[model samples]
Target: MAELSENSSGYGGMKQVFTISLALFIIFLDGSIVNIALPSIIKEYSTDLGMASWIINAYVITVAVFLVFMGKIGDMLGRAKFYNIGLVMFMLSSFFCALSTNVEMLILFRFFQGISGAIVIPTSMGLVRTAVPPEKVGSAMGVWGAVGGLAIAIGPALGGVITEVSDWRWMFYINLPVITIALFLNKRIFQHLREKTQPLHFDVWGTITLSVTLFVLIYTVTKGPDVGWMSWPIIGGFTFSILGVGVFYWIEHKISYPLVDFELFTNKLYVVGLISNLLGGILLAGMMMILPILLTEAMEFTSLQAAYFITPLSAAMLITAPVTGRLIDRFGFFVPMIIGYIISVIGFYLLTSLELNTPTLSILWRIGVIGVGIAMIAVTSLTVSTVSVQSSQSSVASGIFAMVRNVGGAIGVSLFVSVIMTSFNHFSMVSIQDSIQQIHSTSLSTYEKSKLTDALKAQQVSFFDRNYTSHLESLEISKNNLGEWKKMISDLRDQEQKNKVTAIHYAFIFGMLLSIFFSISAMFLLKKSFRL
Candidate 1:
C-alpha cells in the first residue's frame, strides 16, 4: 500500500509523467505505424491477401490478453521495474521484426512486441498516478492522452513515408531512437519503490482464466469466417472461453486480492466509461483500418496517395484532443461528448453517400470532421471514467478501460472485414450468374449456343451428351467466332461487381451510426454527474 501511495502523486510524480508517457507513445506508435504498411507487407510476403490483417489482429490479441495480468503485476513489482523490462522487450522484438524475412516470422515477432506493449501501457498510467496530485490528475491524464492521440495521427503518415522511401522495415527501425531516449531518462532520473510490503499473492487461477478466455474469444471471432463459423474449432474455442470466464469470475470473487475487483462496476461512471471506450474504439479503429485499404484497393490510389488522403483524419484527431481535454476539465464530459457524437453522425452520413468518383479533398474534409468529434468524446470519456473512481482503484480502472479499447478494436476489425468479404463474395457470385444467363439468351447463330452447350457439357457430368458430340462440335466452331462478345460481357459484369464495393462502404456508415447510439447512451448515463 505504501508503494502504491508513493507512486500515486507528488513532486517526483511530475517528472515521471513525461518519461512514462514517452514510453507509452513508442508502444502505441508501433500499433498505428503498421496499418499503412500492411499493403506493402502483403506484397513482400506473397501470402493470402487477408494475411495482412493478422499482423494487426495478432498484435491486438496479445496486448488485450496481458493487460489485466500486467496491471496486477504493477501492483506486485514496482511499476518502474516492469516498465523498463517491457521497454527492453518491445525494443528487442521490434529489431527482430525489422529483420524478418517472412510473414510467419514477422507475426511471431509482432506477438512478442505486443506482450511488451501490454506491459508498457498500463504501467504508464500507474506511473501517472504517482506523478500528479489528485486535483489535477484529470489534466495530467489529458496530456498523457494527447501523446497517444498524436502518435495515432502521425503513425500512418510516418509509416507510409518509410514504406515508400525504403521498405516497410524502417517503421520498426524508427523506434530505436525513441526507446534509447526513454531508457536513458528512466535509468538516470527515475526511482523505483516497491508498493506493497506484504508479498503479493497473485490470483493465479484468475489470471490464467482471463487470459485464456480473451485469447479464445478473439481468435474465434477473427477466424470464424475462414474456418466455418460452426466448425468444431470455433465452437470448441468459444466453449472454452465461456468456461474460462465463468471460472475466472468465481475465482476473482473468492480470492482475497482479485485480479479485477468486481466492486468497481458498482460505480456508474466506470461502467459507462468502459462501455463508451468499447464503442468508441470500434468506431475509430474500424475507420482507420478500413478506409486506407478502400482508398488503395477499391479506389485505385497508390499507397502514398491513400496515405495523403488519410492525413486529414489523423490531423483532426491530433488537433482536437488537447482542446477537448481542456473543455472536459472545465465543463465536464457530457455536453461536449454529446456534441461530438452528433458531429460524428453527420460525418458518417456523408461518408456513406460517397461515390467512386468522389473527390479526394472532399473525402478528407468529411473525415476530418469525424476526427474532431471523436477526439472530443474519446479523451473526455476516458478521463471521466478514471476520475469517477477513488484514487486507490484508479490504476485498476484504467486497466479495464484500456482493455475495453483493445477488445473493441479487435472486434471492430473482424466485423468490418467480415462485412467486406460478404459484400465482395455476393457481388462476384451475382455478376457471374447474370453473365451466364445473358450468354444463354444470346442469338449465337445457333453455332454459339451449340458451342456453349458442348463447353458446359465438357465442364460438368450433368450436361454431358454421348450421341450429339459431332453436331455440337460444329456448333462450337461457329460460336468460337463470336468470342469477342463473351469477353465484352465478362468485362462489363466485372466492372459492375467492383461497383458493389461502394455499397459495402455503407456498412462502415452503419458502424458510425452505432457510435451515435453509444454517444447518446453516454449522455443519458453521465447527465447526473455533469459536475465531475
Candidate 2:
C-alpha cells in the first residue's frame, strides 16, 4: 500500500477521477437533455405545458437551492459517502422519473433528482480531492471540468436525435445505462476513496434561509411573465426572496459553520470571478434562449435545423475549452479572459448585424466566434474563482459561482424578453403612426371622395370646401378605414413585434460588449494578484 503511492503503477488516481467525472456527466446531461424532450413528455402525459414545465424548473430550483448546503455536508460527513448516497438517489429518482405517468409524479421525482444532483456535483469534486495526490489535483480538476463540459455540449444534440428516432422518453432512458456503469465502477474503485469525516453539524437555519432565498428568487423570475410581475403572488415572492437573503446573510455571520462563507466575496479574485460569471452567463444564456426562438419564428427553421445553428458555437466551445483551461493553468487568468471577452464582443457584434437576408454560412461562423468567446470565459472565470481558494473552500466557492451564473441566466432571459417586447412595441407604434400620418396628408381625388361618401352613406366634407359633402364623407371613410387599418396595423404590429423581438437579438450584442468591459476590468484586478 505504501509502494502504491510511489510506484507509477497503472494510473493510480485516474479511475477515481473518471468515476467522479462520469457522475458529473450523467448529472449535467440529465439537466439539459430533458429539455429537448419536454414537449414530447407533455404530449405523452396529456398534461398542460404549465404543469409539465415544472420538470425542468423543479430540478433547477432544487439543485440551485441545495448545492451550498450539500457542499457543506460533504465537508462534514465523508465526501465519497455523500456522493454515493447522491448517486443511488439520483439513479432511483431517474427510474421514478422514467416511470412517471403524470406531471405531479414526475415533478416529485425531479425534486429528488435535484437533491441527488446537489449532493453529487459538489461531493464528486470533494471525492476527487480525497482520492488524488495534492500535486495532481489541478489536472484532475481539469479532467472533471472537461468531461462535464463535453456532456453539456453533447446533451441537446443527443437528446434531439434520441427523441426524433424513438420518443422523448428515450432521453431519460439514456441515463440509466450511464448510471448503471457509474454505479458498477464506483463500487469497484471508489470504495476506498472516502474522506475523513468531521463532526457533523448541519446548519439548519442557514440551509433553510439560503434555500428559501434561492427558490423565491428563481421562482419569481421564471414565473413573473406567466403571472404578472406586479401580481400579489409575485410581489410576495419578491418579498420572501429579499427577506430570506437578508436572514441567510445574518445567519452566516452568526453561525459557527455556515453553509456559505459570505465574507469570501471580499477576496478580489472571488468578487471579480463571481461578477464575471453572472454577466458572462447572462450573455451566453440570453443568446441561447432567443436565438433558437429567432430561428424557428423568423428564419423558419425546424427544431432540428434551429439546433444546428448552435452546433458551430457548441463545437467551437468544445474544442477551445480545454486549450483555454491549459492557458489558465499556465499564464494565469487575465490575458486569456480578456482575449475571450474581446472575441465574444466581436461575436455579439456580428450577430447584431444579422438581418432577414443573412446567409446560413455567415450565421454559422458568427456563432462559432461566439462559442470561442464562451470557451475562454468559462475556463478563465472558473480558474480565477476556484484556484485562489484552498481545497476545503473550493466547493462553497464553486456553489456560489454556479448560483450567480444560474441567476444571471434567469435575469438575462427575463430582461432579454422584456427588451425585445419593448422594442417591438416602440417600433410598431412608430411605423403605424407614421403610416397614418402619410395617409392623412395625401389628398384624395374628387372621384375617390365621391366613392368614399357612398361607402360611408353620409354627407362628407371635402378638402378646401367648407360646405362640400365630399369632405365629411371623406372624413368618415378615412375614420372607418383608419380603424380597420389600426386593426391591420395592430396585426402588423404583432408580426413586426415578433420580427423586432427577433431583431432585438441585439441584446446579446450589448451583453457581449458588457462581457468585454467586465473581462477587461477583471484583468486589472487579476494583474494585482499575479504581480503580488
Candidate 3:
C-alpha cells in the first residue's frame, strides 16, 4: 500500500480514471449523438421545430442548473457515492427516454437524465482527483478530456448509423451496454478508493435563482418567434428572467455558502474564459443545430448523408484536441487560442458561401477547420480558467465554466431557430408578394385575376404558418394536371424553395459573425497573467 503512491495508478487509479471517463463519455455522447436524430423526432411526434428544440434544451438546462449544487453536495457527502448513484439513475432515465412515445415524454425523461448527468460529470473530476496522485493529475485530466473529445467526435456518426439502420430508439438502447460496463468498472475502483468528506452547505436559494433565470431566459427566446415577441407569455418570461438574475446576485452575496463563489469571478482570465465559453457555445451549438436541418431541408440529404458532413468536423476535432492540450502545456494559453479563434472565423466565413450547388467535398474542409478551431479554444480556455484560481476552488471554477457553456448552447438553439424562422418568413413573404404582383400585371380576364388572387392569398397564409399540406389541400394541387393554377403554384413553390435556401445561408452568416465575436473576446484573456 505504501509503495502504491510511487505509481500514479495506485490502488487501481488508472481503471478509476477510465471508469470516470466512461461516465463523461455517456453524458456527452448522448448529447451529440442525439442531435442527428432530432429531425426524426420532430417527424415522429408531428411536433414543430420549437418543441423539438426542447428535446436538447431540457437536458442541457437541467444539467446547467444542478451541476454546481451537485458538486457541493458531493463534497459534503461523498463524491464516489454520489457518482455511483448518478450512474444508476442516468441509466434508468436513458432507458425510459428510449421508450418515449411522444416528444413531451422524451423531454421529461431527458430532464431526469440531465440531473443524473449533473451529479456524474463534476463528481468524476473529483473521483479522479482522489484516485490519481497529485503529480499525475494533469495527465489524468488530459486523458479524461481526450475521451470526452472522442465522444464528441464519434457521437454524430455513430448516431447516424444507428438511427439509419435501426430506429432512433436503438441509439438509446446502445447506451445500456456501455452503462453496464461503466458500472462494473466503477465498483472495482471505488471499493478501494476512499474520499475525505467535507462540511459544505448547498445553497438552495442560489441554485433556484440561477436555474430559474436561465430557464426563463431560454424559454422566452424559444417561444418568441412562434408566439410573437410581444405576446404576454413571452414578455412575462423575459420579466421573470431579469428578476431572477437580480435575485441571484443578491443571494450569492448574502449567502454564507454560495453555489458560485464570487471570489473566482474576480480573476480576469477566468471571467474572459467564461465569456469565451458562452460565445463558443453559441457558435458551435448554433452551427450544430442549423446545419443538419439545412442539409435535409434544402440540400435533400438523408440523415446518414447529413451525418457524413459532420464527420470532418468531428474527425478534425478528435485529432486536434490532444495535440492542442500538449501545446497549451508547453507554450501556455494565449497564442494557440488566438490562432484557433482566427481559424474558426475563417471556417465560418467559408460556411456562409454554402449553396445548393456547393459540392460535399467543399463542405468537408469548411467544417473541419471549425472543428480544429473548437479543439484549440476548448483546451486553452479550460486550462487558463482552472489554473487561474486556487486549488480549493478548482471544482467550482470548472463547474461554473461548464454550466455557462450549457446555458450558451441552450441560448444558441433558441437564437438560431428564431433567426432562421424570421428570415425564412421574410423571404417567403417577399416571394409570395412578388408572385402576386406578377398575376395582377398579367393579361388574364378580371374574373380570372380575382380568383387567382384569392387562392394565392390563402396559399401565402398557409405557407406563413408552415402548414404545407393544408395549403395544398385548399389549392386542390395534385400530382396530375389539375387546372390553370398548376404552373402558377409550381412557380410559387420554386420561389419559396429558393427563399429557404437563402434564409438558411443567412443563419450560417449569423453564426460566422458570432464566431468572429468569440475570437475577439478571447483576446481579453491575454491581458491578464495566468497561473500556468
The lDDT for every candidate, in the order shown, is 0.73, 0.69, 0.73
Which 10 residues in a row give candidate 1 its minimum summed lDDT? Answer: 460-469
- Which scores greater on TM-score, model 2 or model 3? 3
On the 0 to 100 scale, the lDDT of residue 468 in model 1 is 24
Query: lDDT score of model 3?
Result: 0.73
Q: Order of all candidates by TM-score, from best down to worst? A: 3, 1, 2
Q: Could you list the CA RMSD of all candidates, in the order they appear?
A: 5.9, 7.9, 4.3
Which residue window of length 10 is worst by lDDT in model 2? 1-10
Q: Which ten residues in a row have the lowest lDDT in candidate 3?
A: 1-10
**With candidate 1 superimposed using the best TM-score fit, by how many Å does residue 467's alpha carbon deviate from the native?**
38
* Candidate achieving higher lDDT, 1 or 2: 1
Instruction: List, residue by residue over 1-532, the lDDT tens digit for candidate 3.
Output: 0011223345456667777887788888877788777778899999998788788777877888787777667656676787888889999999999999999999999999889988887777656654555444444555666666567666777888987888998877777888889888888776655555566567887887887787778767766767888899988999998888888889999977788778787787888778776776676677777777777777768778887788787777767766776666666667777887788777777877887779889988888887888667765666566556654565566678778777787778778877787888888777777867887886666766676677666654332333442454354433343454556666776676666677777777787777777777667756664324
lDDT per residue, candidate 2, 425-462, as tens digits? 46555554554454445465555445543433433212
Off by over 4 Å in 2: 1-15, 127-142, 188-194, 225-236, 434-498, 529-532
lDDT of 1: 0.73
Residue 322, candidate 2: how far off, in angstroms? Answer: 0.7
Tell me each candidate's TM-score: 0.85, 0.83, 0.86
Candidate 1 collision pairs = 3-195, 7-130, 8-129, 8-130, 13-131, 451-476
